[model samples]
Target: MILFKKKPWKLVTITSTLIFIIFVVLVMASIIIQISNYKFDKSQAKRNEYIISTSLLNSGLSFEVAKGDINGIESIINDYLSYKEIHAIEVRKLTREVIYRKQKTINKELRIVAKTYSLLSQYDEISIDGLDKVENKEVKTIAKVVITFSSNYMNKKITQQALFTGGLLFIAVMITIFFLYLFNRYIYKYLNNIINTMNSIKQGDNITLKNKGIYRVEELNAIYRSLQELSETIYKRDAQLKDSLNQAMEAKILAQEAEQFKEDFIRAISHDIKTPVGVIINLISMIVEQSDTIKDNPSLSEKVNACYESSIVLKEIMTELFNFEEFEQQKLIENKTKVNLNEIFSQIKSLYETKFSEKGLGFSVYKGSQQTTQLLYYINIDKGKLLLVLENLLDNALKFTESGAISITWIVKKDSLLIQIKDSGIGIPEDKYKVIFNKHIQLNNISTSTHQGRGLGLFYVKRIIDLLGAEITLSSKVDIGSVFKINIPITSTMSTNTENTLLLTEELSKSNFKALIIDDDQHTCFTLTEMLNKYGIETASENIPEIGLSQMTKESFDLAFIDFHMPNLSGDVIMKKLTSTLPKNTTFYVCITAESSPYHLEKLDTLFHEVLEKPFDITDLQAVLQKALKSKRVTNEVINNIKGKS
Candidate 1:
């Protein structure tokens, strides 16, 4: 098939030539058989009719002569001239010496013949005793009759049939020849030329074949038509290939530009993360050093805590980017489980209730019928992803609605569960509803407030929903309200277990721990250090891992966060150094690379005891840390719990 597309004319020529030869042979054979059969049938039928008529006439003559009805015979013979039934007539007289025969005194006579025979059985005795045995011993007379009749109807039919058949055969042969010639000329010749042209084209010759006239044979005509169609198809396919190649080249250029942009942006943002964090850490250190001076002022501690919270939020945002990137690229292992919606919703409501009150936005959930509320309250879902989806939606509602109430209603249809989040606020335009879930295409009206998000929240919500294969609908009226209907299936049991591993990890974070940070980016190190400090852990850095072996020798750290990329040494290389230098029992290794390429992750998996992707979230970091820490403890229950939760 591909070859045909590549060189259609060549295939057409070969196929059409074979078909033409077969058609010519079939047509000639049919014509010859029909003509020969027609001639044979006509001649045989005429001869049989003539013999039958002669036999019937001879029988009539013998019947009359045996009766010795001479007058009757004479009358019958005379009557034959005027008898329209007699096709032909002849009369004969027999005597001792000779016999006489004539065809009814007609000037133009048809061919007729007669003969007589004597009875030689009566010998000379019978001839002498003729007076006694046979008084009138006359010589026995016999007659042979032959007559020819012009079968005007039969002959005419035969002649007409022969002429018609011959004419038809000749016409058919001529037509077949003409068509065959046409097929070879217009179709096969042109197709072969086009095939050669196509072959040349494939070999980098771009000459186009000119169009030829129609074919003389139908089969060849079809081939020619297909060739034309094929030519067009090839032209179109070539154009498409060229376009695709150009697009691929353009995408390559764009990717390079994007990579450069990301590099520059990360450098600049790294400074942003480190500068404030460094200042706050220094201030905290100074405050702790001069604790006696501000012992009475309690607001200072509060101020310190506020600064700490801001820094943590910043770090969290960055870490979330890392987690989301992994999730988007399908790198993160999804710890899915059947989530009780009612229980989770209750927790979210309690957590956000104070905030909703502070903002004076009415937030309520109406407990409808058991069937309706059951769908919304109980669903088997990925609790973490579901939380994110709800958080994004509620955040949008609260951000947009100032005075109006926000209500969440549940509708249980026959096939699906629908949870509608209605907010009385500046509604989204109908046109924007479809694009609102898209990254960076937030609703126009909602963008008026200072609560402008990173534009990834809704995108994340949509991603999570899609991962679960759920349906969502958004309806709104401008300045009135907006309703988002999320329909999740009731039978979505991603996993059979219901244990919350996140809470377990939160409990494990109470212990004091030591961690090693190996990253080229200073911001990543500082940000992660701050977040980890909140969980009572200390972080040390080894930028570029220049003295990785030296550092591990000096400090016996509990965990190592190694970035995959460095100036010369890679994260896996640093890990190898740590494993060789550190104690034989040390298995605290995590790879945190921002390369985002698939190869990096595959390589990371083979080297690290545990892999933590960059832009680490405190929750994820704590979880990975706990898992790594628990590896040393080797608790079967914890392992089972983690497996069950997952």
Candidate 2:
């Protein structure tokens, strides 16, 4: 409404007023010139006719006198009158000496009379028409005839003059208007287009023009040139601004990537350092335990164990930090396959029985009513990695929980398997429940239980859950308990199962088994061989898979420990070659370099019977060796566990 009340209406008014003024000026000037010319033509025609009539009458009289028609002057006049060319003629004897007068009469009373008849003499006429000199001189020869030549010529002259003058005036006006129209079309419209383009620029739209031809106007053409330059400048500036914005955005993304990389690097280093330190502390504790067995040393044992426990706590913290870092980096791998949570839970329960019994904590498992022995487990996950996450959670729960029940439940939600682990430990602070799954974070309010950890169990659990694209939530109250719920999407496919179960075919328990160990690192091979020798397995080292394979072919070895990553060949190749040569009854253990790769274990199942992750403890290695020793007499359940799903 405001715009309508503003410049548009004003512009319309000015343009219309200018057109009206030009039209009126042109038309009025044309009319005035035509009227003046009409009046002038009438007056000029009357004067011309008067002079011609007076001259003709005087010349006729002079011709009669020169021919000596003194007495017959009237007769000569009458004879000319018969031609009807001279309107009337009169010859009078004036001063008794044949002075002649010729009068061309008009309207019988008004005449153009000439008194001097000589051929070279001048004649004059007055407005009072009677001849004064001939009136007193006599009527010796007098004949007067009248002819009038009035034909409205003055009116006709005025009409023709008006038409000619008006036509010329109209032509002048038309030419002026045509040039004016051309000026508006070429000059005015060009200027207006420039003005409109400027307005569009001010409003931030692309500027362009339709140039029909070069403008005749100097000012308008100059403005057109200037506008083109301005448009180019504006376009270039806009492009530069867009480029600057893009650069800033790219810089921002690069900075964020660098920051995330730094966090992940720190986390990985911390985890790497902590694992070895934990191993050293646990080894020292084991040594102290052995020394205590030979002598009474409770204080020393407790001190050494406490040191070992501290190292375990540090290891947990570092592991959780690493998991969080990987989660943030989106680098955590999810090796999804169906898993039997019941089978997993059963093992956990059995492992925790001794610990729970010592702590006076009741632990039990209630199998669900589902009739499927295989449990129809369809979970997408890395089974070993997930189990580690659950192991940490359960370990923390059991440690904190003295004289209270720890339970594991598997309930079905829509299209999901919801696993719940609840404990009756000194519960978490309600406010801290949300933060409990973060690395290095601990609950300050739980002061009753003598549990120790780096507060990383739940964090690793959350990371594993996230990697699986699952959901986990925590609920707790002070002095009551905490419940952790995990939901994983389930399908109908069977999961790959890999568990070591073995039976001895012969009674050769006391026989010393020779073992060959191959690893790139000398310290790793020596340490592993020394630990195995104490377990009654005599061991040797090749330090590389190729040499180990060459040595194994030459020597009749009972078993081979091949590192998954070696200088000469990968453990998979060694396992493949060994299984091709050795009998199916023979056992091979493939040692892994890192715990992150579950596919390696699945691959190992194709050749070897057992696969151990690096930095395995003495007890874990002892269990693997025992299983290998009893491989020939394994039960169906044991075989099924060892042979992963194809």
Q: Which tens-of-lDDT digit does each residue in 375-396 have in candidate 1? A: 4334545555666677778877
Q: Which ten residues in a row have the lowest lDDT in candidate 1?
A: 114-123
Q: Report the C-alpha lDDT of model 2 over 89-138, residue by residue, as the tens digit.
A: 44433333435444444354332323233232333432332243223232
Give per-residue lDDT, candidate 2, residue 120: 28
After superposition, candidate 2 runs with Cα above 4 Å error:
1-296, 336-384, 388-419, 423-463, 466-481, 487-516, 530-538, 543-591, 595-646
How many residue pairs clash in model 1? 4
Superposed model 1: Cα runs more than 4 Å off: 1-114, 117-332, 335-391, 404-456, 465-544, 553-565, 580-583, 590-606, 610-646
lDDT of each: 0.60, 0.60
Candidate 1 clash pair list = 179-216, 182-216, 183-216, 319-615
Residue pairs clashing, model 2 = 62-117, 336-381, 337-381, 503-630, 504-630
TM-score of each: 0.48, 0.48
